[model samples]
Target: MPRYLSILTFAAALFCGACQNSHSDSKNQSSPEAGVKPAFVAQRGTPVLDGSGSDDLWEASDWLPINQIWAGTLPKPDDFSGRYKLAWDENNLYILAETTDDVLLDVHPQALEHFWDDDCLVVFLDEDASGGTHEFSYNAFAYHIALDGSVADVAPDSSFRYFNDHCLTRRIARDNVNTWEIAVRIFDGKQYKDEGDNVPMLLKKGKKMGFALAYCDNDHSAERESLVGNVPLPNTQNKQQWLNADVFGTLELR
Candidate 1:
């Protein structure tokens, strides 16, 4: 089996960003409430910056084998990928994800699939060694989860399925710029997917799981918080040249 590359401390420090702000209250990471069995994974790689340009925290496939990863993508020259930076401080883990597209994003999820063509960010976190899974998927518009087994997306507005009970928060910003970010906390299966053979897959209390990224066919259709940022956003016309996207954050486990 191939060895899993650990993230370097030098790179991880460079990507560190403060999460304190008016929006910080929306997502709180305090571990599973009391008796709740928190889902978790072992601390894998140290936080690091993965992208082109030494100062750029978002690392492109240039350094690592992008194509080698399942559903991963390589960015074209000039345009950039999403920015990802991770950090963990004793009690909680912090992760930030962002992407830049030459073609402005199409912020809407309707029909069978629409946002599938645009860019997106999919995150998975399992704090415990159990077989359960905690997923947070988002497009340029909104975000959703499969807490346990229920699937949520930005399309058709933010709604919940009867599958299971879990916590979810959606944030949309700079959608016109073709950029977006999400803050998540995986505390328990009840807060995520509530039923069925639900078990932690990629993460465990002591074991570790690899983080992944990819740019494939547009398979998203949902409503998003429109045109953010006062600055003029990138044009989404005929700019076939794909942009680069990366994630950054740290993982802290006990």
Candidate 2:
């Protein structure tokens, strides 16, 4: 099983809960009676990772070994150049990824309006296998309707069954280095620890936080590179078609 990697790109937006109001008018696109598409559907970005990326940008030694690190099949050693970095602090999580493709250069001029097809990053967190509930997310826009929301085929009109009230604050900034930084801040009901009683128990019982991430450009059929960490994932001994982005010693919590 490939571990997915997540870039925290919405700490501020989550802390503010600003986009929730705008998405209010939007309802599930799939109709139960006739199965109609959504009113407004968006496109996804292309996949650009060829598996040749630098592992040095990560701080692996700091993370706990809940699971073993599994390697995914590389696209081809000499094929293409792709690199990414993962790091964290006591207050925020950071992910820096870069690829050699020029198609990802298209930028979204609007904020909180673009869907998955636009060069975007998705984050999965609070994975709970024992409880039979896993949360999948991308910034504040999430689809809890079905945890089966695979990043492989994310459609803008795809209707999610459950949309959590929680918000994910992120800030995605591009630099001249041809790299982008996705800083995410998770402000779940748990974040209000100062006001909650069970928070301490949740924190001490090894119920901290974890993440999975995937980046895509415009290619809907192209395979995407992903990373997973902290989540008790399934065994990936035979699945070679999908790449695992999750790495040990990669994520941290505040």
Worst 10 residues of 2 by lDDT: 37-46
**TM-score for each of the candidates:** 0.35, 0.35
Candidate 1 wrong stretches, greater than 4 Å: 1-69, 78-80, 88-93, 107-117, 129-181, 190-210, 213-254
Question: What tens digits encode model 1's per-residue C-alpha lDDT throughout 1-254?
Answer: 23333345544554453323312532333222222332232232333322112223223212211121122233342233443444333333434444444544434333224333444444433333232222222212112322121223432224432311222223233532322222333443333333344432232334332233333323232422121111111332223211111121112343
Question: What is the C-alpha lDDT profile of model 2 across 1-254, one tens digit per residue?
Answer: 22332223455557346445433422221111112211111112112222222334332322221121122332221221233444444333444444333344223323223333344444444322112122222212222111122222222344332222232222222332234444333445223322234221122122234344433333232332222122223453334212232311112333
lDDT scores of the candidates, listed in order = 0.30, 0.30
lDDT of 2: 0.30
